[model samples]
Structure formats: C-alpha cells, structure tokens
Target: AQSVAQPEDQVNVAEGNPLTVKCTYSVSGNPYLFWYVQYPNRGLQFLLKYITGDNLVKGSYGFEAEFNKSQTSFHLKKPSALVSDSALYFCAVSRNSGGGADGLTFGKGTHLIIQP
Candidate 1:
C-alpha cells in the first residue's frame, strides 16, 4: 500500500526564522506528494503538491517542498516562520491511479511550534 512517514512528532522554531518538517513516502508507481497544515482541533488545509514536474514546488502561506526520488523524500520548507504558522503538519501521498476514491494517504502528524 502507498504510505507516508513523518519521522518527527514535533518541530520547534523561533518566529521569523526559516522552518522545515521532514517527510518520506513509499508507493508502487510515481508518488504524488502533498503537504497539509492543521490548526488546533481543525481540519487540515492544503499546502503544496508534487505531481510530475519540477522537483521544487511552492505552495500557500509561503511554504514549499522539494521532491527527491532518490531519498523518497518530500520535505516541507518556509523561508520565514511565524507564530501563526505554529500548527500540525501532515504529509500525504496519492496513488497514480485507481488506488481509491480520493487515493490520499496521510502521515501520523508533526506539530510545528513557532516561538515568538
């Protein structure tokens, strides 16, 4: 089955500093990479995705990710951090075809803490 792994349970960063949260994935075919953010007791919000183009992809809230085939990784990054950016982050993968209705699989979660 296609799956994603978020090794870290949490990340702490200072406000206005760059931040990152790591993710790795496994799938049968070429993986579709996605990043999502979640606030306290709220549903996840879409961040970015890597379908089949450039390795580096940008997304909402000034966030971005790099897709690395060799490392099987899709790490999320931001140039600067904000206290409002402190939230739960999730990495996801979708099958190339016919995997499921939505075909999305998500990681456990990673809590990002941005200190002011």
Candidate 2:
C-alpha cells in the first residue's frame, strides 16, 4: 500500500522568511510524489511533482522539493514566504509499480500560515 504523512498540522512563518512543510511517504516500490495547494474555498491546484529525474524538483510559485529516497521524504520548501502562499497543502503518493489507475493516497494536509 502507498501512503503519505504530513506530521505538522500547521506551519507558521513570517512573510519574507523561508518556509518548509514536511512530508514523508511509503510505497511498495518507486513512488510518484506530488504536492497540491487548496485555497480558502477553491479546489486543489497542482503545485509540483517528482515522477523521475533530479532529486531536487522545482514547481510553481518559486517552490521546490527535495526527494530523499533514503529517508522516503519529499519536503516542500520556499526561499521566501508570502501572505498569498498561505493555504492548505497536501502531499500525495502513488506507487510506480503499477496498480489499477486509481487515485493517489494523500496526507491529511498542512495549513501554512504566513504572517505579515
């Protein structure tokens, strides 16, 4: 089974400061990891993904994530935080080993709070 864990319920950062949202995943084989953000009342929007390639994957909005196989972690990072960045972020994972084309397993979510 594939699973994602977001240990933090919320992450707080001052505007202009760097921000990090932790994420860890488990899968039977190579994992396809993804990040999504949800606004106040809007649906989730794709942020980035780590399908294959460089361990460090960059995504929209100046955000980037490092895929650590040893640790089975893909932590999202941004050099600077903005009020607009505050939102609910979710980490998802799917096994690359091929399962029926089902949906991805997602973590609960991490509420990012950027204080001005």
Candidate 3:
C-alpha cells in the first residue's frame, strides 16, 4: 500500500516568516507525490507534484518542494508566508502510474495558520 504522513496537525507562522509543512511517503514502487491546499468552502488547489526528473519543484504562490529519495520525504516550503496562505494542506502519494487502478492515499491535512 502507498501512503503519506503529515506529522503536524497545525503549523503556525507569522506573516513574512519562512514556513514548512513536512511530508513523508511510503510506497511499493516509485512514488508520485502531490501537495494540495484547501481554503474555506473551496476546492482543493494543486500546489506541487513530484513525479520525475527534478528533486526540487516550484509551484503556485511561491511554494516549492524537494523530493528527497533517501528520506522518502517531500517537504513543502515558502520563503515568506502570508495571512492568505492560511489553509489546510494535504500531502498525497500513489504508485507510479501504469494505467493501474491505484488511487491516491492522502495524509491527514495540516492546518497552516499564518498570524499577521
């Protein structure tokens, strides 16, 4: 089975401060990792993904993640957080796509509270 874990239930950061949301994944084969953020009454927005090639991938809203093969981790980072950045963040993973019937296993979302 494939799964991802976001250890922190909530992460608080002051505006303009750097922030990080940790994620670790376990999979049978090569993994496809993704990060999504959800705001109040809104749909999940794609933040970033780690499929192949680069170890560090940048995404929308100045967000970026590094795929660490040794540690099996893909932690999200931002140079400076904003109050609008406050949202529920989720880390998800799935087996490498092979037209298989495997679905993504999502982590318990971590609420990122950015204090202004």
Q: Residues 9-62, candidate 1, lDDT per residue (tens digit)?
A: 999999999998999999998787899999887888999999899999999989
Provide TM-scores for the models. Answer: 0.94, 0.95, 0.93
Candidate 2: tens digits of C-alpha lDDT, residues 1-116: 78899999999999999999999999986788999999988999999999888999999999999999999999999999999999999999975545678588999999999999
Give the top-scoring candidate (lDDT): 2
Clashes of each: 0, 0, 0
RMSD of 3: 1.4
CA lDDT, candidate 3, residue 33: 91
lDDT of 3: 0.93
- Judge candidate 1 against the unseen true structure and give its global Cα lDDT, from 0 to 1: 0.92
Q: Rate the local accuracy (lDDT) of all candidates.
A: 0.92, 0.94, 0.93
**Residue pair clashes in candidate 1:** none
- Residue 16 shift from truth in candidate 3, angstroms: 0.4
Model 2 ranges off by over 4 Å: 95-100
- Compute the lDDT for candidate 2: 0.94
lDDT of 3 at 43: 89
lDDT (10s digit) by residue, model 3, range 2-116: 7789999999999999999999999877888999999999989999988899999999999999999999999999999999999999999975556776578899999999999
